[model samples]
Target: MITDDLIVKMTEFNAGDPKRIQHFIKVYEFAHVIGAKEGLDENTLRILDIASVMHDIGIRPSEEKYGRCDGKLQEREGPAYAREMLAMFSDVTETEIDRVCFLIAHHHTYENVEGLDYRILLEADFLVNAMEDELKKDAIITFRDKVFRTKTGLHLINTMFGLCSI
Candidate 1:
């Protein structure tokens, strides 16, 4: 479980850019709303929130090292950092840590979503990304056809953002 202290620390870690921290918070909020609608277990929802916060932790490093910030690089650099950052939480089991780490590691790729929790986290991230990218008037259609698959996630996307058609 991510404590308030842990969140504070993480948000403060990257003082140079608050947008990254805020982005994670938005993703975490979105994940929480959809996770509840999906009826995820308490433990799983906690993991999802933690994963949501850590998902973009890789961007800064990727920018510094490779000049390119993207999903693959995020996946590549996220896990170990998540582990290091999450070490403060004594309640988090090894399995929880690993699962959350895996989610963060692959949050951007979206190839294999094993459960609703993961799928919702992906959707939440997409919701934020969509907001950032001027939604193609066709996004709702594309999202319906290609992206918004899970009922809870789709509901959040459409209800909060707008209707993304199917």
Candidate 2:
């Protein structure tokens, strides 16, 4: 129920911004698929879902305040909103909320990533971003090499971008 609630909250938060809402939803779905394929446990999968949905939550505030939404600003501002949103649900544990917030804050960092949830979240975000940005094959390949870790994430990238051997 909290997961469903989060989705609705995210949708409401990005109201009138179809692009942002769609982006987060796509990222959430991709992360779910990849996490399942990777055999992530329930807890990690839940965190990945939350992080994916709230990862770019800082964008609106960042754009409003700074007239732009960059990775750093998103990372810097996201956790507070994530925390506030997560607090609305009583079933979400404190540790779980903290971990989700941490993942949201570091989702764009891409370095020193320590967990499956984090890696999948990053991969899911990149998958959507590559398509939305219309990145070249070279760039996608570079990102696959540089950022991808899990087998499922790599496979999705290869398949989505036609880098796989058929």
Candidate 3:
């Protein structure tokens, strides 16, 4: 229920920006699927759900401040917004908030990914981004090799991109 509330709040936060709203929704769906398929526990899956929805909360701020919302800028500005928005929900624990903020901050960083939630967040965001960005097959393959770890994520990418083995 909190996740549902968060989704509504995030949607409202990005009102009139269908592109961003759709982007986060897609990422949230991908994260939910990947997290479920990867056997994440309920709490972890909830964290992933929250993080995926709030991951791009920095885009508007970054655009207003710098006229662009690059990954680094999103990483830099996202956690504060995430914290503020997450604070509205009394049910969300402090630990959950910290982890969600951590995911928001590093969703773009692929190196030395530590937690399952982090790994799934990267893969889910990439799955949506690859399509949204119209990345070439070679680039998708490169990212697939370098970033994908979960079997479900690999399968989704390979199948989505027509790279899966027969």
Candidate 4:
């Protein structure tokens, strides 16, 4: 129920900005699919769901402050916004909030990914970004080989991009 509530909040937060609303929605779908396929436990799946939606929460703030929102700025600004939004729900515990914030802060960080949730988040975001950015086949392939770890994620990227498996 918190996930649903958070979705509404995020939708409202990004009001008049369909691009961001749709971006988060797409990321959430990919995260859900990749998380399920990767067999995440219930708690982790819940965290992944929340993190996926709130991953870019800082974009607005970053843009407002800096006139541009890059990955590092988003990572820096996202956790506070995520925390504020998460505070609205009593159901989300501190532990959960901490992990969700951590995920948001590191969503764009690629090196030494630890948890399944983190890895899946990266894969899901990359999947959406690759299409949204209209990246070339070679770039997709490079990311697929270098970044994607889960079989489902790799398959989706390869299939979506029409890249033959290496």
Best by lDDT: 4
**Ranking under TM-score, best-scoring first?**
4, 3, 2, 1
lDDT digits (tens) for residues 23-55 of candidate 1: 778888888888877788988888887887777
lDDT per residue, candidate 2, 1-166, as tens digits? 5767888999999889999999999999999999999999998888888888888999998998899989999889888988998888888889998999898888888789899999899999999999999999999998888899888888888998999532
- On the 0 to 100 scale, the lDDT of residue 157 in model 2 is 89
lDDT of 4 at 27: 98
Q: Write the per-residue lDDT of candidate 4 for residues 84-120, one digit (tens) a residue.
A: 9899898899999999999999988999999999999
Cα lDDT of model 3 overall? 0.92
Question: What is the lDDT for 103 in model 4?
Answer: 95
Give me the runs in candidate 1 sitting further than 4 Å from their true place: 1-3
Please list the residue runs of candidate 4 whose C-alpha ends up more than 4 Å from where it truly belongs after superposition: none
Model 4 Cα shift for residue 31 (angstroms): 0.4
TM-score for all models, in order of appearance = 0.90, 0.96, 0.97, 0.98
Model 1: lDDT to the true structure: 0.77
Candidate 2, position 158, lDDT: 93
lDDT of each: 0.77, 0.89, 0.92, 0.93
Model 1: lDDT of residue 66: 94
Candidate 4 TM-score, C-alpha based: 0.98
Q: Return the lDDT, model 2, position 123.
A: 96
